[model samples]
Target chain A: MSEQGPAFDLSYVANLARLELSEEDVAMFEPQLQGILSYMEKLDAIDVSGIEPTAHANPVLNVTRPDEVCPSLPVEEALRNAPKSANDQFVVPKVVE
Target chain B: MSLASQTIKGLQTLLEKKEIQPKEIIDSVAEAAAVRDGAIGGYLGLDQELAHRDAEEISGGVLAGIPIGIKDLLNVKGQPCGCASKILSNYIAPYDATSIAKLRASGGIPFGRANMDEFAMGSSNENSSIKPVHNPWDLERIPGGSSGGSAAIVAADEAIAALGSDTGGSIRQPAAFCGCVGLKPTYGRVSRFGLTAFASSLDQIGPLTKTVEDAAILLGAISGGDKNDSTCLDESVPDYVADLQGDIKGMKLGMPKEFFGEGIDPAIRASVEEAAKQFESLGAEIVEVSLPHTEQAVAVYYIIATAEASANLARFDGVRYGYRAPDAENLGEQYAKSRAQGFGNEVKLRILLGTYVLSSGYYDAYYLRAQKLRTLIRQDFTSAFETVDAIIGPVSPIAPFKIGENASDPLAMYLADIYTISANLAGICGLSLPCGYMTPSDGQRELPIGLQILGAPFDEGKVLKLGHNFEQSTEWHQRRPSLG
Candidate 1:
């Protein structure tokens, strides 16, 4: 219930998300982060004792269609959309280098 | 040549009868756009050549040869889909959104791309990095957003109808503010394959049109299973147009007391009450209903939505696609600098809050709890539906506020979405239809107000039928903004 709950530590979350947070952003976000977490704590008091967890409100039925391969946009048309490309693959900065 | 005053249905009738050719309609629509769009700023981009070509190819449908605006968030192949952000300024869609494809199949001419809040983050269209879209009713005011341009374009008759995406009231709020009809179809009812995700769990592509029937026809054409979207349901897509006039003679309508309580404009309350009386005159029963957890909808919605948005937008790290900063020394700096420079203030705030909530210790306390509240909120609707066929309320607390009035305060912007966000969170169908207008005590001018109708999951027909019935009993939808 305290503002100092889980949302305060940005580094822990940044680690989980594989994001590296700057010191400036972490300092700036602390209070705003605390405000959101405290608001969420209000939900902790609600009772759901025998209620079944529903992932989707609408009834979930399998939406299976015949496994048929369909034609896709021609490679030229597809590649025409790439901002930067070499050969047939999208060109990106080398991560390993 | 004043096609600005004509409804989509009226224009369609003219085209079918050959009284006016598609080229003539496009010409008139173009002229209207030139005259009115400058004041309203509804369009982000207008493709006259593409529109003329599509107009020539129009064969038949309820929307035959109708010039329709597409929200910038929806992919329209070969067109810039900037999403009203400088970050995406150079991004052109490689393919059309599924709904856009359906519109083309039905002979809808894509006229232009409408402006929106950047990445669909804000309730006011002012969040758009491009020129702000003004309310056609009053140029000094805002058109409710992130679907503001779509609603304003239809309101100003710049286009016959526009495709809008509703994630937490984006379509309906703008429709309400701009004095038009907008429908948010049930989740997974329409394909979301090409939509730029804001909050995936809440997003549904819907229609912003001049009338309820147009909304229904548009919904019928777009709603169905798509192999590209796994969330799409396999349920049978009923002909919404065919079911438009079904009898709701004795159906029960729930009037939630909480929605009509304090903070709602008195004029809006009167307007909705009058609409309820009209529904009763049509033999429908008005039953008072309680959605006990209604007050908590906004609080729960923000937490869950931002969490989902954080996850969805994580892909835009300037790595695989989109704009990357050129001066970065390493990958880490590249992502940070790119996202920081690319995203707008509101977008950045949400991303920060989302990352905070979903972070290690916070995930259990904030994200998990919010998900559980979402269940309770859905349950409230489930139980309420047992007593009534539909629920009614004001689409927003007040008519469109003056432009720039709420831009500085983020909380004020979020408050405008209070009444409309719950339906999206609960994954149900809802519609906003013009009911009446708000005339201040000083009597300067009357601004429009809307009556929102919400129905059970996949009950769009019932929602549309009720909305159509209400429109039939009132002249609100027929009244156009005086832009001349």
Candidate 2:
């Protein structure tokens, strides 16, 4: 928490979130970044003794239905709603060179 | 009958008598939407053809042929689920959300999708990428968000009832602002399958209705076990409708001291106190209860919510489905450009905060500690329930602030959800119903204020009974937003 995260280098966050924040946004968000960090710092005051951490509030149990396959949306009907598609598959720009 | 005055039960009664056909109800609702929705911005999109078709198919159920609005965050098969964001502008859902399926099975007419904050992230509806939903009471004020549209539509009588999701006061706060009944069911009461995730652990699908009885009927229809969502409880969902008229006599009600303390607007505070008096008049015992951890609720909520949000939103990369930016040179750039171009400022802020807190080095000090505090907060409620059957508080510190009042300051906007979010975080059932109106000291207009009733885990019956008793004694819920 010590090292001042790069003034404009949210490239690390961008990499982690697969997001591309503009250089302008990174500059704007820099000052406010510390406020969020400080807000999280307030949690350090709470004392947790003999407390078991809970991930989900309800008791965990497997919710399974019978293994019967239900009919799916037809390919043509499903693809009809897609913005761009070809050969019954969603069309996308070429990725691999 | 005018669509505005017909409750879900009233409509069902008319339908049973064949005095009003389902088609007539659909047409009346469509007419109301056209007249009222333009001013309020309650709907993102409306499907007249599908709605009519659904109404025509209505045969028998509790809410048969009753038109309902789905929050844009929930999936409706083949409809554009914008989630009020530009990122998924053209994304159409391939499946109906589990709650929607339940509503359909129970004969609900899916009239339209309601607007919400982009991805259920903000308190005011201003965060919506598409359009801000205005309060029907005063067009200049907000209707509250991310469930703002759901609340507004129900308040304005554009829909008899609407389904909404609460991550952190998304349902209750908006319901309070719009002067309607909103319930955030016990976390696992409703399944989360196909409701677009904001904070998976905290989000619960519930209803916004004109009356507590309608809310009870809607919750009964939609809640139960779901195979698709593993987090949903397997326990039998009790007949909430049967318990709607339960005796409130001799029931113990706790009034949390912190909730009604300073910082609460005097007018709103008076409204809650008056509501407690009404409960006492109804023969329920009112006792002062203290939740010492009340001040830490907001900080604890942000940390835990953002951490879960960071993990849940990781699925929105430009991969399997949803928005993908065009003209990216590589896979990495594609993922980055798609999200960056797609998400709004608030959504990005949460994602960044979520990712930062959950990051490897800071995980223990930030995320882990927040999780530990969450347990303590839950225990605070559990211990208080030992002394009282239910806890009551002011739903929000103030009545609906003007639209742009807190938009600039994120902290001010976060504080608006202060009293309501803890119920979501603790995974308990809570409902907000109109208690009275308030006129601010600055000569600002009077708006509706709500009293929040929270019950023990899976104890919605107690909360509903208390709300029902209050509604029977007072005429607050009877007052409609002056849309004219």
Candidate 3:
């Protein structure tokens, strides 16, 4: 994060991003992030009042399928990418006690 | 030249006559890889058996028997879709991405996993955590990224052509640097279902090939409506190859003066100006147009792209699949550690920047403001197309630099995509083809510079026609890097 980021709370933002940074990463990235964020500040000068935000370049109508069960990835294949799996379910750290 | 170096049209003709078997094309590609990949480091993996299986199963698709390299991000069933990052290094794709399925249906065999910047993040291939792709033109210099491997290998003849995803200049910049033909189709022109998401709005899958005609063929194969990707407009895919004939007589080409302004390499600008004159000679009218919002393109792209990327990448949390940090006592620690350890530095920086912008009290200022600027950027194109049939410019401001030259300077690196990023923002088709060369004074050998042709949304046929005509007239696309 940038200096403003640290001032505004980079750890808070990192926690939001779910990325843990090492001391080296923070040290190396801080000045760089500061530079990038400062560059992004250039956007502030533009008067974009009343302009609509474009979420998609070519926005499509909400597509509705027939909702029929199409052939989906088999359970085994779906689980194939999991780092920890059993019984066709991903095993993960406990979410609840 | 080996068969692998031949254009798709050349190979397809021979295949039609039984002059060469499909497997032989795969064999040629394998041979090229053995000779060239060791030096270029363009491929992450190549399975001969898979290539042969694809070749054997060919059903006379349009690009029959041709082997096209697959960028690591796109899913090929049972193949690792690493996206050139360690996070998903162990993950094998469960099914073919729509583009791959369509390409396979066209009889183009997916040959190898080419390297890329981790999750298609950076301007140079140096961002690849797996291995950086070297520019085949000059072994020590960097191939532009995140489609660097796709472009490098196509230039090196390791694969007949390759699939590359362009979020912002991933395909075009690398194509310019490595001297290959790269096309970034209009956003939503090609489905994004199977390809790893970069920024949903800006992300698109296109081709990196040896010729503009080859790009046309591949673009034809992969583009169409997909049930899986809603944004893939129901707009019909045209016969891009058929549009290639006829001179560009009386066609209007716009040269945006903002892009040609100071800070671009004089040599590159001269080459493009020379190309504009060439286009004029070929009967196209070159007109000066202004995209006033051009200066804000890079800034807006970083904000909107990173904001979306922050959201898209949230799926990588160590849960259902992908790399999981070992020995996490809690889910929070797991998410943090997995991303920190799994991603490279640039990825982390972008995520942090994105997360910050989207964070409370800041979202309205940064992300929203950038989005509004994006609309103005798109309007610039809409207005430009009113007078010009297509826009022409240099792909990048400068030639390919040496490895580590801008590695430490992230902002400097981001600025390199200045010429290419707005096309993505505007959701238009853009093509990069060789126009001229930069002969270095130091005897380091000459490097290739590319001329970029951008067309209106779903106007790929027009751009392809323009690029193909130029390619047929000039000998630049014919020049290949000499392999020892």
Q: Pick by TM-score: which candidate is best?
A: 3
lDDT (Cα, tens digit) per residue for candidate 1, span B116-216: 99999888899998889998888888899889999999998888888999999999999999999999999989999899998888899999999999898
Q: For candidate 3, what is the DockQ?
A: 0.82
Residue B142 lDDT in candidate 1 = 86
Can you write out model 2's per-residue Cα lDDT over B7-80, one digit (the tens) per residue?
Answer: 89888888889888887877787789999899999999988888887777777788888888899988888788
Worst 10 residues of 3 chain B by lDDT: B438-447
Q: Give candidate 2's root-mean-square deviation (CA, Å).
A: 2.2
| CA-only RMSD, every prediction | 2.6, 2.2, 1.5
Residue B331, candidate 1: C-alpha displacement in angstroms: 1.8
- Highest DockQ: give the candidate number: 3
lDDT to native, each model: 0.82, 0.85, 0.91
What docking grade applies to model 1? acceptable
Clashing pairs in 3: none
Runs in model 1 lying further than 4 Å from the true structure: A3-38, A49-54, A59-62, A73-83, B440-443
Candidate 3 deviation (Cα RMSD) = 1.5
**lDDT by residue for model 3 over B328-439, one digit each (tens)?**
7998999999998899899998998899889998899888889899899999999999999999999999888888878789999998889999999999999999999997
**CA-based DockQ, model 2:** 0.50
Cα lDDT tens digits, model 3, A1-97, are 2436335566788889999987888788888878888888777778988999987788777687788988987898778778889887988888898
